[model samples]
Target: MADQVLMELGDRLRVARKVEGSSGAVLASRAGVTQPTVSRVENGQRVSSVEAVERLIAALPLPPEEAERLTSMAREAYALASEGKRVDSGVSLVPDAARKLFTAASRVRGFQSATIPAPLRSSEYAAAAGADSDSGADWAKNLDDAGKSFEFVVTESALRTWPGSGESMPAQLEHLLTLAQRPNVSLTVIPWGVGLPVMPPHGFTVCDESGVLVETFTATMTLTGSEHVAAYRDAFEALAAVAVTGDEFRRVVEDVAADLTRFIQ
Candidate 1:
């Protein structure tokens, strides 16, 4: 969704530049931004800052309505990354928009302290947890996209707590193990005995270092400001530091799954 907005804005800006008979270099000088930045904006690639978009708008010889339209589009493009807008809907409730973020990003890092991360959730698990079962389909498909990488750090308790039926949980755990084996996927688990470096209040996903989506009970907050995103990145790293990965992670999950299997029997 954000990508679409940026692309449209880029197209409009390109047309406006042509109408003004301005070269990319001329526009860059007029906007006081680098030529590459101007090129990126015109190409619909994410810009460094919202200020760059504003400056480009200011430099362009656009009519009042067109200028406002482009400005609006710019805001929407950066709304999740710059303004840190809060959407009332749960992240899972808007699958299409959320899917776009994953599709556009080259890397996605997520930390879940309570529940299974959405991308790693099985359909049955998601349905049992009251999340839209189909919401995670795109993520599952994206696992095959070798160009993108996904990393998830989850607490051991989250894996132990089965939201679905006893029979369903084994499948979910199996799904996690399968996903963990993917070349581009990394699943890490913080064991029960591991001491945490910091306590995170909730789960958050950072997309391509561009924005962080902090998930809460009622709404999801988009923190795109560089500082806020950096903080979340730090938090994720803190959790990942104490988490087990590779064979150790598999053992932890397998241990939980084994216990569950015994209990189910």
Candidate 2:
């Protein structure tokens, strides 16, 4: 298989600039490069030389420590690009990789049209879905830190109708309700059968300004290019816009829980 893994230099640069409130034009002006060059470099599309990247870093005006870290990241990114491809099993490694994304990000966003987000899934439901032992509160622990935010959206079909876990569905719905009440958690359910002009082919999780993790049946892909991250971020925001929440969403949960209770009884 061709190598799909990538390093996150562009994403790092873009995020650092946002944190510093520097515009592309401003960074370009400071770095002695055109805005297009700054844009391209931050998206990891093109850079003429390592010296140019150094100039871009200097433009960020990062403190000495941060600048050095970014320089090292740029080198790793260049190395990865040169190699072009790496293949890994990714099953065992995904959990730790996900943990890293969680710990590093202050904000997280997720979209799942077919199932619940892992962070909000009940232990039993997670197990039913063949998720790792890391579920329920353990998943929440991934977000247990200062200044963290989680926004997740799932289709109504996924939220209320988990198959193969008739007994666990109620508890999972209740768990969603519980997470919905938390200050830092925003759980939205898009109504069943809502027409979306563009339905996402697969679920994805975005970590703050840098990372996007896409889950497949066999492996999880950690995406790093700034352009790709930006695209995922835009998709997340678009989905979040139309999702149902607040009391309306609560009522939907209640309805589902009642239905589940009747079925189990």
Candidate 3:
């Protein structure tokens, strides 16, 4: 589990670097660390000092507050991993804080790189995903209600890949299609050919109706203040602009689902 936590953190770091249009070599150069150190840090093989984490955070597009939060998360993660615990599995500061943030949020915007959003996922898909333990039934209901207030953006790969926990690709894509028709839910797809401007990775950003919560396998980063929230909001909108919506989005999902069904046959 400690390894899981570390790897999760690493995944976030790697993805964030990509999202910022940076390479490990570039991050190392900016952070004043060796390229190997950067790779190990991003891979969760080595624990980073708070100061070192701060340096890397500074290099990212995050605000000071978020950078501090991430630095704190890294420190805590390092401590837990040293104790042979998964940073988020136990009743620790990270998971508790993440749950609170999720509960407190008035709205959410879940983005997926290659799977259906959990909030809209069906029982079949959820069961297939083996997501049983991490989140509970009440949490699912909260998301269901919150789904009325949240929006979502997914990439074309998510519709096609079924890379997340699920029974089958068709089931997941059908789930996406069903949720896309919901009255309060807005679903859009970033097509395959548009080309990602920043970087492509799997993750979600939540707007707490006031603040924002950014999740990675390692840390649950909270971003308060209107300025920070606005930045993510703008990004979501921009991504949505180039995406397909309404009938077009539905058609794409249907096609993907058909392909999956064919593969099964």
Question: Top TM-score: which candidate number?
Answer: 2
TM-score of each: 0.62, 0.62, 0.56
What local lDDT does model 1 show for residue 15?
93
lDDT per residue, candidate 1, 1-265, as tens digits?
8878888889889999999999987998889876656767887777657889989998998998888888888987787554554443222445354556656789999998778888888887777777753345545777788988999999999888866465668888999999988899999999998887667788888888777777666555566655456556766776787899989999998999989967666
The positional error of residue 73 in candidate 1, measured at the CA in angstroms, is 36
User: Per-residue lDDT of 30-117 in model 3, one digit per residue for the tens?
Assistant: 9876555566667666433546655777788876776677777777776665584343432223455655666677777767776666
| Deviation of model 1 at 99, angstroms | 3.3
Candidate 2 lDDT by residue in tens digits, 106-205: 8899999888887887778877777864434566776555468888988887766675847778888887888788888888888876755236799989
- Give the worst 10-residue stretch by lDDT in candidate 1: 86-95
**Whole-model lDDT per candidate:** 0.78, 0.73, 0.64
Query: Per-prediction count of colliding residue pairs?
Result: 1, 1, 2
After superposition, candidate 1 runs with Cα above 4 Å error = 1-97
Least well predicted 10-residue stretch by lDDT in candidate 2:
1-10
RMSD of 2: 11.1
Clashing pairs in 1: 81-224
- How far does residue 90 in candidate 1 sit from its true spot (Å)? 17
